[model samples]
Target: MNGNRFGRLFQLTTYGESHGDAMGVVVSGCPAGVELSTEDIQRDLDRRKPGQSMITTSRGEPDEVRIQSGLQDGYTTGTPLGMLIENKDARSGKYEPFVTAPRPSHGDFTYSAKFGTRNWGGGGRSSARETVNWVAAGAVAKRVLEASDHDVRIKAHVSQIGDVEAPEVTFEEMLEHSEENEVRCAHPETAEEMREVADQHQTAGDSIGGAIYFECRGVPRGLGAPRFDGVPARLAQAMYSIPAVNDFEYGIGREARTTTGGEYNEDWEFDGNGDPTPVGNDHGGVQGGITTGQPIYGEVTWHPPVSIPKSQRTVDWETREEKEIQVVGRHDPVLPPRAVPVVEAMLYCTVLDFMLLGGRINPDRIDDRPGEYDTDYHPRSPENVDD
Candidate 1:
């Protein structure tokens, strides 16, 4: 309950259960005068919503977003942006079998132990369904960054599904082709392979783990602090917050383990504009805990979804007897495809928070001019001739 909020200056507080009335979020500290609409948030929600394809959950929630507050005309008001998404297809009956038995590798046991009682319906608040709020808030963050002077762009793609891995792709390829396939991998051939893998798992009543590759471009330098507050540290926290995300790594990532220091360390040279630049991007944009004005890229790995049709053993806490449970429900066989947007959203929120903290973008308003009411982003009064 206390950990629902995220970010420092640009904060997001979420509320709701997976099978409850609706999921909602209140985004605070967003600058006023940035153009935003429910459609903008809905676009990202559509990507993360359940029942997207054969590989994803079969639940039929529309995930349509409703903007409840914090806007005047069509722009943000610098107040808490309240948004809501109702759950239309929540079938709590499917989860009743595990209410006391608890599913394997799930938070069911821990939640019950900690809270004494829980919603116990669709995993309650621990569900990835909660990320709907994140994608909503991240849409706002993305719009804020776009409307600002910074040209920050965040993109993520499904890089691996089970044992099938995609070939390395450029940012341009991600933009052009990631969404073209159901797997959301940038490489079309690999995406087909990933899809086939997911289908195999789905047919077997099992689930598979996968990884997502994310990149953030146009993020300014000096947007992060040292040690605990490093950009990489915060990003890791963001990525790990997503359910099932077991691993996070940036820069050369695991490759740095075997790489020699001489080969891993990037040499600095003057750019054509005379600014110091690294000859290569093995560091993935951050050096010494601060951004180096280069692209920040990384991968987030998720464990297989615990909820599957396969029978798993667990104990019924009340009966004190063992039980065999089939977590049969609408569930995704692979996670990376749906997770791509979530990764991008978290990156947008994290990057925008650092931008505001670093004074690279205005915290109060996108225009950066305080007490000046008559800006282009603001609504204009009706002309006198309108009478």
Candidate 2:
């Protein structure tokens, strides 16, 4: 019920549940006078909306974003911006069985243990549906950041599905090709293979896991605040909030553990003015928690959809008796495609927050002008923050 809010200066709070009347968000601290409207936010929601393709859940919610406050004349008013998306596709009948028999790999049991009861319909707050609000709020943050002359961009694609691996593609190719398929994979050949894999699992009444890679470009040389607010830490925290996400790592994350120290260390280069730039971008753009003006990259592993039609065994929370459970509901056979925009929004929100934390970006001053960013936020001291 608590802790749904994120960010320091430009913050947001999400409310409602998956099967509730609606799910919505209240975004605060955004500078007024920026060009915005329901369309700007709806564009991202359309990408995140469920039932968009055969790969995602069959639930067809319009995912229409309604801006109720904080804007006048198509601009922010510097007040809390509230928006809502109704849940038209919710069906509680399928979840009736889960009232007593908790679904494995889901928060049903933990939620019951922590709270006396839960909204069993569609996993409630624990559902991936909760991420819709994030996508919406992050769209707002992205717009605010764009107005400041900062061109932070996030790209995510399905890197792996079960055992299938997508071939490496350039960021430009990814932008062009990822959305062309239901799998949202950068590689056309591998996306076909991934679809075949998902179909195989669905036919067998099982689910498959996949890995998603996100690349952040155009981030400043220094952002991320230090102590507990490192970029990687915040990235992990935001991503972990999504259901079915089991693992995360940055560039050379586990790979570095296998290499020797000298092999893993990134060599440095100097600009004409003696500024440091790594000869190789092996660090993924961060050193000591601060960005180094290189691309920031990382990956998140998404566990297969937990609510398969196959029957599974679980203990009854009420009677503590073992029983069979069949998870039946509107769910995605593969969720990677729908998750891409959400990932992009979150990365933008994180980097934009760090940018504000490092300097004073008056929301009121941001506009359509280019190269108008206030440089006071660029971190001059590496020790102050983590990238």
Candidate 3:
């Protein structure tokens, strides 16, 4: 109910629940006069909307967006921009059983304890559905960043679906391939395999978890607040807000913990232009809580959807008795592909806030850089590409 706002200078506050009639966001502190419209927000929403692929939930929500205010003639008015998306396909009845029996691996039990009651339908505020607002706000933030001539772009893709994964591709390549498939993976072969696995899991009444890799381009140095708003902390905060995100890390994540400093620390050097250049991409673009101006990259891992058609044991909070619960309602068999754009939106928001803090660019006017950076990231196909 509280703490929905993110960022200091360019702030965004999101509200509404999954089954609520509508979800929306209010963005404030944005500079006046940047090009924007409901279509811009709707474009991203369409990517995150359910039923886009066979691997995702079958919910039929169009996730249509409507901009209530904050712009004139397709540009920001410098006031708080308000936007909302109606939830057209909610079936609150699917959550009737959870009135007493909470779903495991979800916030229901804890929310019940803390709030003493909950909407239960579509997991209420805890639902991944809430992130639609983030995407909406992010669309505006992205425009703000773009207007500043920052020459930055954010993108995400399904890197791994259970055991199937694509080969590591460059940031530019990933952007090229992400939107090509429902799984939002660039590699055709791997996306197919991942889709097959998702289908199998759905058939078995199960769900699968996977990893999402994100890349940030053209982010100038000195964007973080240090010690607190450090790049990692900000990115982590935004990433964790996505429901089902169970783990996060950059530059090897847990793998780094297993190595010695000698093996882990990235050695620095100077490029021919005398600018500091990372000897390797090991650090993933952040050191000492600030950007190195390289591609800021990292990943978010989503746990398998906790709700499954197969019955599972849980306790009836009121009865204090153990019982089997078959989670009903629409649920994703796999969330990686659809999550790609959502991650991009969050990354966009994070970078926009960082850029604002760094003063590298301002809204209303942006520098002219014709595709300063080109992304070459491509997803690997599990069926053909080898590790």
Best by lDDT: 1
Compared with the true structure, what per-residue lDDT tens digits does model 1 show for residues 1-387?
599999999999999999999999999999998988888998999999988899989899999888999998898889899999999999999888888898999999999999898998899999999999999999999999989988899999999999998889999999999999888999999988889999998999988999999899999887799999999999999999999999999988999999998999888999898999999999999998999999999999999988888877899989999988788778888888998989999999999999989998888887843355655553355552345
TM-score for predicted model 2 compared with the true structure = 0.92
Q: What is the C-alpha RMSD of each candidate to the true structure, in Å?
A: 3.3, 8.2, 11.4
TM-score of each: 0.95, 0.92, 0.91
Task: Rank candidates, lDDT, best first.
Answer: 1, 2, 3
Clashing pairs in 2: 225-385, 225-386, 226-385, 289-386, 289-387, 290-387, 358-377, 359-377
Cα deviation of 143, candidate 2, in Å: 1.2
lDDT winner between candidates 1 and 3: 1
lDDT for each of the candidates?
A: 0.91, 0.83, 0.83
For model 3, the superposed segments whose C-alpha errors exceed 4 Å read 363-387
* Candidate 1 positional error at 371, Å: 14
Best candidate according to TM-score: 1
lDDT of 2: 0.83
Off by over 4 Å in 1: 368-387
The order of the candidates by TM-score, greatest first, is: 1, 2, 3
